[model samples]
Target: MPAEFRAGERVRVRAGDPAGHTRAPRYVRGQVGRIVECQGSWELADEVAAGVAAPRVEPVYTVAFAAGDLWGEGGHEVTVDLWESYIERAERAERAGEDGS
Candidate 1:
């Protein structure tokens, strides 16, 4: 199935450190970014690490974050491939006046 998020959509990395292996990094958790590309479906890393056969799949998205947004300043923009489970639509309050709401 196609991914929920399309290119250009804003998303925030889900926060939390689940027990065992995970691909989401701690630094990127709770950070907002724009989806740059859709990388289709991939097997879940956590399940694979646990040796689960027929593990569930998830869509992967390339998200871009501005350097200033992640840090104080001077850092260049960075893009990272994140699984759908790791991100969600950025909150309405986060978007604020952009939606004219």
Candidate 2:
């Protein structure tokens, strides 16, 4: 499948406590971040770990989250490689309101 997000696009990590293993970091869940790069398609790690016979392949991306946004401290950003299913496009209107626009 084609990548759902491109570099420079904003996305919010899906927030949920899944029953099984997941690659999405706990701290980044529900946080908004920018897609820094598309890492190409790869087998879904969660499915692979679950022993699925045929894991689905999906787009992966490098996302950059502001440290302040994730922990309320620091000026640096943290980058994480996340699967497409782990994130959703962040709404533009919400972003505008966040920065007092």
Candidate 3:
């Protein structure tokens, strides 16, 4: 199956303070990042955490974030692997001079 997220696509991590076991890191929550790679599907963690017998599956992706975007300047860029469910489509501005519009 095709990956839910594609490389070069901008996506945002779901923001919330829910009480439960989750794979998404707290530091990345609500942060916008570009998908660097799609790691394919895997067993959903939410189902596992909920104790479901038949675990659901979802695509996982490696996302890249600029240091300045996540933290103040002088920080280095970082990347994290996240599940599809942990992120949502985020609108991104066109690259400069790409469209020539």
Candidate 4:
């Protein structure tokens, strides 16, 4: 019921603006990550996403990105705290669909 998301899963930040100051950076958009931890659920904070006052609590996940995966060799491994709504399932399914051919 908490919008199922699990660790070791890859996700990318969704489009649209989120209210308040968040650690999820714009450069992180479309960046792939592996869920490291789940923070359960809490009232959707106005600062977390575009402030619309959505009463539903948004689950939070700690996503880890490889330095090389995100940036070039100069980039560091960044573990970002992302909301459940901000993520999309990885493209593995899409690739699988292509592989079926």
Q: In TM-score terms, which candidate is top? A: 2
Query: Per-residue lDDT tens digits of candidate 2, residues 1-101?
Result: 99878899899999998989999999999999999999999999999999999999999999999999999999999999999999998988988998799
Error of 1 at 36 (Å): 0.3
Instruction: Write candidate 4's Cα lDDT for 58-81 as tens digits.
Output: 888888887786667656678887
Q: Write the per-residue lDDT of candidate 1 for residues 1-101, one digit (tens) a residue.
A: 67999999999999888999998888789999999999989998888998998878999899999878878785788888898999999988878855677
The TM-score that candidate 2 achieves is 0.95
Candidates' C-alpha lDDT: 0.89, 0.95, 0.83, 0.72
Query: Which pairs of residues clash in candidate 1, taking residues 3 or more apart in a chain or in different chains?
Result: none
* Residue 12 CA displacement from its true place in model 4, Å: 2.0
Give candidate 3's error at residue 2 in angstroms: 3.3
**Rank order by lDDT, top first?**
2, 1, 3, 4
Residue range 1-101, candidate 3, lDDT tens digits: 45877898888899987678888988899988889998989988878998989887889999998878777764677999998989998743543333365
TM-scores for all predictions: 0.89, 0.95, 0.81, 0.69
Model 4 CA deviation exceeding 4 Å by range? 1-3, 15-23, 47-54, 74-76, 93-101
- The prediction achieving the highest lDDT against the true structure is 2
Q: Give the TM-score of candidate 1.
A: 0.89
Clash pairs, model 3 backbone: none
Worst 10 residues of 3 by lDDT: 91-100
